[model samples]
Target chain A: MDYQRKYEKSENKNIKKISIIKYIICVIIIPTVIFIGTKLFDGKKYAFLTAVVVLLSCVPFIISFEKGKNSTEKMVILAVMIALSVFGRYCFSMIPHFKPITAITVITGIYMGGEMGFLCGALAAVLSNFIFGQGPWTPFQMLAWGMTGLIAGLLSRYLKKYMVALAAYGAVSGIIYSMIMDIWSAMWQDGVFNIKRYVACIISGIPTTATYIVSNIIFLLILARPVGRKLERVKLKADIIEKD
Target chain B: MNDKMKIFNTYHPLGLFIYFASAIVITMFMINPVMLTIAIISGIAFVLTLTDIRTFLKNLAYEIPFFILIALTNPLFSHNGVTPLFFLNGNAVTLEAVLYGLDMGIMILGVIYWCKCYSIIVDSEKFIYLFGKAIPKLSLVLSMALKFVPVFKRQYRKISDAQKCFGYYATDSYFDKIRNALRVFSCLITWSLESSIDTSVAMKAKGYGLKGRTHFHNFRFHIRDLFLIAVTLFMDIVVFTGIGTDIIDFRFYPKITQINLNAESIAVYGAFIILMFMPAFLEIKEKIKWKYYVERI
Candidate 1:
């Protein structure tokens, strides 16, 4: 039993080491792409650059999913989280910018870990776009929300410990989502990332940003505890089923 | 609704994928006025052949506004180039900006139309086949998620009804309504996660995601499909070469660049025209052949 425990600890450490390597590689790729993107690309190219960015950002999560020992239950849970988020988007489609998508995505990340969270966020963006008429903004939407989930999952422990942290994270997530989306607006307008154009886009979309912040906070605060409890039960339930 | 009515259905999924991918990528890369215009016109013209007039017109109704919105929005934010056309909020809404906006709109519209054609032709089943081998897990997830959306939508209705029965939701007070809605959402989340356990068990029992899995695809790459693919490849190469050599280059910044109508430009344009309008031509040919056979019979 002692031997088994020691072996497991070593295995866990190895896994952690591998994940760090994975992240470092993924991190290196993104800034390189961005650096090249800024240097080489101009108007019309930014749209494709954003698309390339989406692909590069998503590949790591997908690679992790492929490599990891993700059970069927976890996959289902991720799908369910995405479905719930998409449903949330559908429910409040009549109300502009008022969506539980960010809250749900954040909660998903917190429960499912960073990789699943990223997939959840990105897939939700893709699925919602499918439902809501895909446009030029779809890739950016995926990038923003996918990163939101990724960061939330990575910082899940701290957020879980403190209510204020969770709320603050939720607000920050909204800002991040808004800022990333406005990148598209800036790029689409002038074919490059001009600060003047970007700020103008942001200023114009202030109402949207406010709505995102409000909805994210409201939904996160209301749904976090319950969703966390449910996800815990779900984890337990999966374990029980797996034993059978 | 008839598959015979459209030529898009006849090609193999690989052929279809290559065509659409090349078309969209080519259209996206170029900011040339003439090139973008060709793309938009071809997309519209090709899509018209595939879909019915009424539905196309209905889609067009919103699409026109979308195009206009993108076009106008471009000028609003962008203050690039010489030749100021007008002043909007202490910014020069220059001619370059205006023209650029129009080009972006055209490019966006072209992509949308081609994608619409793609979606209409390549159903989820075909998509699964196309991407299944390359990204098996992602494809599985996509198929599973697509399946689950409707399943969960039904579940949502069931949960909402039960919640309403318990006086949980379906109230008038705004804050209360929002609270009640969240409760229903919470309830659904629990049910969904609970059900996911059962789904995973069921999927495992059925031996999903097992190694040595064989996927059944009825997509036989016939000679005609190969022919279509070859032509698409040839045209794509020609067009890409045009872009690479700056033969098809037209700019709309500072001042709109004059369109070159030389041999290289014409070759580039010809390749693009053939590629984009291939489906329409094929559909017309098919219709004529079908009519001739019917008349003979």
Candidate 2:
């Protein structure tokens, strides 16, 4: 058991080291690729290339799951979380622009760690779109939701402790989602990015954004305690802990 | 399944995936109005061949309003172009902007139709097959999630029904209804969490993620799949090189350029149309052959 603990400690250190590289790729490499690719390639090639890059960025998170103990259990928990999030979206389908996907994603991050949260969030977007119909916006949706989960997971320490902070994070996530999607809309509108058009897109999307914010806050307030507690119990039962 | 063998249906999953991926990428990148028109028409034809007239019309019905909204909104926000059509709030609405917007709208509509067609062709099994080799863990989780969605939905309904029998959800007020829904959702989370523990234990008992774990594959790449792949790659090369070399140049902003019609450009267009409607053409050919065979009999 002592040797097992020492091995896990080393693995945690290695993960920490590798995660910095992942951050650099996600933050620096991806944008640079997009910027350079757009400048060099035509709209079609650029769009395809960007989608591939975004999908590739998810590899680190997927790989990170293997470094932990009880990988199968972690995977099962993630699948269940993704399924529940998708089901949450369906439950609120009657309400226009109101969804619990973001709130659920944020809570998942807060409990299961960020990498699992990111996976769940990203999977929910694609899986839900299987029923909602997919388009060019699918990649953008994945990135947005994935980032939401990542951010929530990164801030899980604080978010788990405070109810108010979690709700605030939920509202911010809604805005971020709208903003990312608006960028896609603007890019789709004109082959090039036009500021005036992007601004107009945001303005037109204000109502939907408002609904997102409201639904996120409402859902987070309602779900964080119950769902978060249940997730905590699962984590305890599985004996999975976030390796420092 | 063996009763009617169409080319697309007979091809390897990889070949089918390549066709749709290349088609969608090329369609989205194309800015030339002429190319877009060809794509839209082929998209419609593909939809018709794949499904039925009802589904084709339904897709178009869903797309038209979105098309109009995008086209109309472009003229409102984008005031770029040479030919001014009118002035709204001191902004010049140009014919070019409207036309540009119309092109974008058509592109989006075409892409959406193509994606819908793609979904019909590529089921979750095919998707898992394509990615499963590279990311075994992720694929397993994805397939599991796919399985769980229907299960969760049924569970939700059952739980809701059980609750309703106990008068737990009998509230008439909107707020009360929302509260009751939240209660049902909370219950679901608890149930799923408990159930997941059982699933994980079962999976572990099966020695999942063990070393040298072998996966079962039903798909095999035959000689015909090779031919299909070669043909698609050739078409993709032709189209991409044509676009790369400016042989199929098109600009939508400032002013719409007249499409240059030459042998190479026409060839590119033909290649694109064929590639875009490859599956549809195969299905049509099969239908014709079946009719002829029936008549001879």
TM-scores across all candidates?
A: 0.86, 0.91
**How displaced is residue B151 in candidate 2, in Å?**
1.2
Query: Could you give candidate 2's per-residue lDDT for residues A137-192 as a string of tens digits?
Result: 78788889999998998998888888889888988999999998888888776556
Q: Which candidate comes out best when scored by DockQ?
A: 2
Q: How good is the docking of model 1, as DockQ? A: 0.50
User: Which candidate should be chosen as best, given lDDT against the real structure?
Assistant: 2
Give the range of the ten consecutive residues with the poorest summed lDDT in model 2 chain B: B1-10
- After superposition, candidate 2 runs with Cα above 4 Å error: A1-32, A42-53, A66-70, B1-10, B171-173, B290-297
* Error at B192, model 1, angstroms: 1.8
- Looking only at chain A, give the TM-score of model 2 against the true structure: 0.83
Tens-digit lDDT string for candidate 2 (B1-297)? 331244465567898888888888888888888889988888887777777677677766877898999999888877878999889999999999899889989988888888987777776777889988866787888889899888989998888989999988687888777877888889988998899989999999999977888889788999978887888899999999998899999875677788989998999988887777777788888889989999999
